[model samples]
Target: MIWSSSRPQLGFKRVAVVLLVAPIVALAPLDPVQAQQIPSSSVNAAELISSLKETTLQSGLTVAATTVRTVETTTNLNLRSSPSSSSKKLAVMPKGTELSVSATHAGWSQVRYGGKTGWASNDYLRTVAKAIRAGELGKTTAELKLRQNANTVSKVLTTVPKAGIFTVKRISGGFAQIIRRGKTGWVQSKYLSTVAQKPGREIYIDQKYTSNRAGLTDIYWTRVSGGDLRESVNGKILIGDIPRNSVVYRDLKLEKTAGSVSGWIFVHTQGMTGWMKTSQMSRKSTATTKPSKYTAKQVLAQTNGKVPEKMLAAIAWDPEKTLIASPALKDLNRLNAAFKKKFGKNIDIDLAYRTRATQDAYWIKLGPYVAARPGTSNHGWGTAIDMPETYDYSFRGKYFKWLKANSKNYNWVHRKILEEESPYAEAWHFDYVGR
Candidate 1:
């Protein structure tokens, strides 16, 4: 049964009345006169006026009908008459005490225990659904490293072989601290599983994009001129050419700059792990742009300098109007597709892929404060674009909201909003940050 408590009011009330009346008033049948007698104060006013804050038996307190176990196994939890620790102590509750929570306030929970109504700290409480305790057996799915601490960078004490079962001591930060062959240490949480449940799926280091379950759902079909499944990332050892419509896993980390196109993503189907060009991949690919090598000073001096032939050749122009880095073009195209689908039109782009001279000219006109100093501009990297004719944050239309929710999947981000105290706060400026 779902247990709900009346929204408590912040007003002066006796502590005894608050403890006894609140829970009963919540379940009591009410008539018009009773309903009128029940206090209903504005929540906004209570929150705004801190001094007026008070918890009453029949007001402001919420309770749950379900029983929960205490997580603290070694020590007793102090039960208080009121929510505050400074309040009078009612009893000392032993570890693993099952409590039926009637209401919760701040960090304290009001529970019914041994025919007594009192409050206990919420920190040591856990629901029955997740009641795993220390010394329980668990197994690691893959060859996992046991570390000194919960963090990934912690020193490795030893390695747990694939499917190695161990006794769990505790869990923190998604890592399980366990005892294996009398040795206690921490291992990556995703790899650990309960005894009955099998270990997590194996994930190779190079296959960084395949770890998250959310990413697995985003499967895209192949749309390549000629697609081949290779054994390695460079695709030097070609296994064989797969059919054009084969489903491939998009590894976000493997997407790198290759010639004019930046959409070379590491993909795998069955046992074939290989690199595939963005053009060869159908649907959306989570590819991002690599940072430009030219610094502000470099760009100023290299106005006449040529962009690398490999990079220059990869530049893809959409309908001959907008020029973007070949690697980022797919994302840009995807963004446009989404924008068109939602708003019945494409986003109007005013500029993309600026030359050093063009950037220097903008710097001269807008100055460093209003614009990025020459080479540092994202536009020069061919991974940024200016939407509409001008940048304006004040325009909060449906188009802007759509862009906010959808742009990141394509690696596009509004720099001004993401960065703090940003000198370049253009509302219309979006840069690819996937790299």
Candidate 2:
């Protein structure tokens, strides 16, 4: 400390300066806002495009804004350099003009205009929203069958194969809720078509009706009474009191002959009386009537000369009017002859040749009639006859009974009788179907 130099030392001065600068040094923290403001070098073109694609896929926003890639026009149109007409026209883009995109300059885009690739206005060309791909739309398929349970062994709702198409309303997990043939049901989404959805209206089957006690009545019936059958009311046939809607099959005809009311047997459901219309009845497509495969000579031989020529002529003219064929008529003639031989007289015919319309009307009046019932009736076959009281008094009593018992031999069968549960007690009713 006491040492001193006569001359100034430059090296010592530089050393003093370095020592002072070293003491002033210290570390300071950076400002958060300033750091955030700095530009990042990480973002690039590929990253932006990838992010946009991923977002679109996840959000299900498949729609996009689209520009006209090509403008096809029938006539020559002006392509303005600007979006407005006041702007200069780049050129006249005639029909079949093709333009390549130069750039999307502003609200007005720049596309190759006229012959050159200079900027043409975008104001004229309309913009349209993009549509979803065909693969993305819902598809529909027809239902082959309806199962009561998930198991394949479940009960079937329909016997015949019914047709129905299903619309894929929604899809979730592995199951899809679809409107199958108008009914909503669940099906595997994989079963549906992956292509475009079908578009059309659906069709359905008609409703069915069932049988009843007071006679046939569909869901449409509101009232029914015993007096509905005119013949039964006139014949005074006492059809046992039947509860409404109770199903009854007609088996025999109950009629009053000569003031004697009795039941006469027919085919299936023998001694069956009356018919009921039910909600189970369904509409049939067609009904056909054919003549019996017997010749006139065979018919005459079978009847043993009992049937009248006039009746035969009538039947021949309209075989369908009565479900009787020549063979059936032949049998009825034989039965009629036998009855004549036993009872000593020809039986009278009450009603004959009832058109389908008339039969349907009668049923409707009676408040319900089932079409297909067991046992064949003469009225149904058409070769039969109904002996209503309005026809003749001889049609009632023992004559009618004797005829009923021996009529089958001659091929005659009683049509609608109270015993058959038929609304009408046709004492003289007879059919020609051979037993």
Candidate 3:
């Protein structure tokens, strides 16, 4: 169901109506106080189901038979009311103490303890329940190996040692489902104590966009300009007056003859919808990328190979142009490779190599060119790339935020933004200082 911000009370009323209208199956009675406390009216089950089916195969569904699933002391562990620590804390579960699994909500699995049923943050859980197997080893799958050490490597399928015994839940591909501690993930099927067969279905949401905030009704029912809502396969269209990153759930009707069933769609910021064939949405969590195939030497050589002359010329004559350098064809190549490694794509270099004559002219026309200023500009060398702010200006955009988080690993620094008395907050400027 879609939630509207305007009558929050009305939203509650609708939920109540849906609950009353929905057939009351023989499911466990949920704690109403716990359900009412969280504001998740925006979530749509249709969309969530669609998202889930696309990524992973469906598994059997069952309600929690117990109040909470406790992680007793193997060590001193934190116990929070919600799955996130940002929520409230009830108490820390001492060694050998029991904790209750209150509810499975969002990414967190809620637990109850100490006369309170709050959330225990899921971050500390070392294992995940669902994971696909990678390859077969003996009777079991091989232990899963991570490309890098990160939290994202949670549910990988891999081979386990033969002597190690694990409680097998199921088998998918070459992996075995096993519970390690209290968490579940894929292990080698050969290492499992036993295997069980289960039937399941996968579901996912058909979102219209990649960004969460576009094409949703929570902010408004119609476009601000009061026009009929029209969607296009190519042209950019503004959704209703929704926030920039809001996500929406839409139900689609498909042709039965075509073997297509109607489902929900998720909208992103770019006015595009992400379509899903399945019925469940997985929580957003970090996942590690495969290590780059390119060696560091190869990356450096490619970066130093060529600079886009036209891009540099565009920024050369700018009124605020401070310093400019002749494009180092090789350095530009290395920069591109480095960026792609970190961001999974090429770095957009607004300014490449510039001629000294053009630099001088700009300096004379304006004041001291940023590059000509003493002891300041990395542009003096050929290792800098200036990103354009707009199509025409030298400002930054969403891409800049990505650079800030990752550029350092590649020896790139955003010189202008780091300056205390910089002329402008130019987010697109980057310089490669050798690591």
Candidate 4:
């Protein structure tokens, strides 16, 4: 049942006359439809809004209606006797309290509680939507880190891509513990938006790609013939292929959440975006000139310092286009691949194979101590490499140490005679021991 006082702005005389002549039916239970039909001028607009709630009277024989929409307090707010902030304070509404709103004027809402009606600022009130409770799936609103712990300084285990979805296992102070792809970690709770229900199917990103989801700005090129781009890594769907040495752009953020499988990087080439194996890409521009059609054996059979340029493989990762024996190029490429993975760049090369005339010129310019006697140097064989004389390639540098230890795995090794204390020592020299 619902009841309300006079809705009109009655003066003292009119209020007294209405009280004396009002009929008992004015206090009777109301039909919901009839209640709505009653004009706003006939009932107290400040006392009634909707008739959905049922409130039992103290005698327990009658009931009153309630509102259909509710507003919640977001912080402690002053309930004022009038809509103005300077109005007299009636009470203080605590955060999270739900209130039945009867009317709104200016920027304040008139709410009812405990037989009292007052106005509150709209700034501290919000519509009642279901809170994102536990056990729900949420999607990331930005690229975020999944750390081992809930703090920003904790070890970052992986990346949660923008729009990546995960199940919320629990939430801490400012972070949410989530599980994605069978791995569990914590991410900022504020960055996740809850979903109503689980998705019908999970997305197709490979977990390895998210371990380092940062955008890449470094340029690269295709190292294989007709480097192919597939719809997915290890996927049979072929998108297209680009010729060797074709420019590729890997620093991409397409679809906000695209990813790749292990050993594959998502890239854009020839106006298409797809996956290309990491093995088939390099920072070094491949030579357009093909390796001499002759076999490595036939080239080796020729006299030292007389090998033709056509018979040699142009080092694809070398910016200077240095030539090397075809047999050694593959292993060199492997070592460079690993180096780039560790250092985020290609190795700098100062020299590779030296022709007979070039070796003679070096001997006359640098003297016997610095240059190999014309034909006696290993540089004439197209198998020795000289790294640029940069601090990174020095005997005491990190690049040198890493190369000394790991290059052997790819059949490239630094000889002991090149140590700093040895005669004719050269710290920048490395040899292809495989051939």
Best by lDDT: 4
| Candidate 2 lDDT by residue in tens digits, 1-435 | 000111122211112223223322231111101124334444333324433543545542322225344333222344554433344655555433444444444333455543444433343343321222211322323443443333346554432122222333444554455433334444444444332212101001121111111132222210222212223323432232221221223322322222323332111111123222333121321112233454644543433213332223222222122223344555555665776687676545433433233344333332222221212233433455544332132233576667666766665656544322222223545556553
Q: What is the TM-score of each candidate against the true structure?
A: 0.28, 0.24, 0.23, 0.34
How many clashing residue pairs, candidate 1? 12
Stretch of 10 with least lDDT, candidate 2 = 196-205
Identify the superior model by TM-score, candidate 2 or candidate 4: 4
lDDT of 1 by residue, 190-293 (tens): 67554431111112334332222223444565554236554454546443443334456665544442322355666654223456666677663222233244
lDDT (Cα atoms) of all candidates against the true structure: 0.50, 0.35, 0.35, 0.59
Model 4 vs. true fold: TM: 0.34
- Per-residue alpha-carbon lDDT of model 4 for 126-232, expressed as tens digits? 87633333445567779998898988999888887787655566788778887654457888887876654322101113421111112345467778754677767
> Please, what are the lDDT tens digits per residue for candidate 3 over residues 193-247?
2212110000112511122222233221111111211133223332222211111
Better of 1 and 2 by lDDT: 1
Ordered by TM-score, highest first, the candidates read: 4, 1, 2, 3
**Cα lDDT for residue 372, model 2?**
18
Candidate 4 residue runs with Cα over 4 Å from true position: 1-298
Q: Which stretches of candidate 1 lie over 4 Å from their true place?
A: 1-306, 309-320, 390-394, 416-423
Predicted structure with the largest TM-score when compared to the true one? 4
